[model samples]
Target: MTTVAARKALWKIPEAMELLSISRTVIYEQIRAGRLRTVKCGRTRLVPDGAIAEYVALLEREAGR
Candidate 1:
């Protein structure tokens, strides 16, 4: 099994999109809605590993309700 350590702590927008199987619009929407957190460095936006996991967990919790 792959470990978390094997993954990057920070992911680019396209990488996040691919990993989440989501579109750029949806990502931006989520960010706008304060569902997902991100970091900005220069001209790049980065998603932290913890934020992705938190978003997924939030989805799961919402689905259970």
Candidate 2:
């Protein structure tokens, strides 16, 4: 997928995992621990584009931003 589209889509959990190369367990753990923000619809969890960016920024900040 193009960066433009990737920048636009609100990723479902599997898609987010594919892009981040993170496992489902880690993702769920992050969501539950509030390190990442997520929205749930029934049994499906969706992660926001902004949340992913913010989360990455948080990691960078924690590393000494």
Each prediction's whole-model lDDT (CA):
0.94, 0.85
Give lDDT tens digits, candidate 1, residues 1-65.
87675889999989999989899999999999999999999999999999999999999999999
Q: Mind giving the per-residue lDDT tens digits that candidate 2 earns over 1-65?
A: 65653375478988888877799999889898999998877897799888888888888899994
Clashing pairs in 2: none
Off by over 4 Å in 2: 1-6
User: How close is every model to the real structure, measured as TM-score?
Assistant: 0.89, 0.77
Residue 23 lDDT, candidate 1, scale 0-100: 100
Candidate 1 contains a number of clashing pairs equal to 0
Cα RMSDs of all predictions?
A: 2.6, 3.3
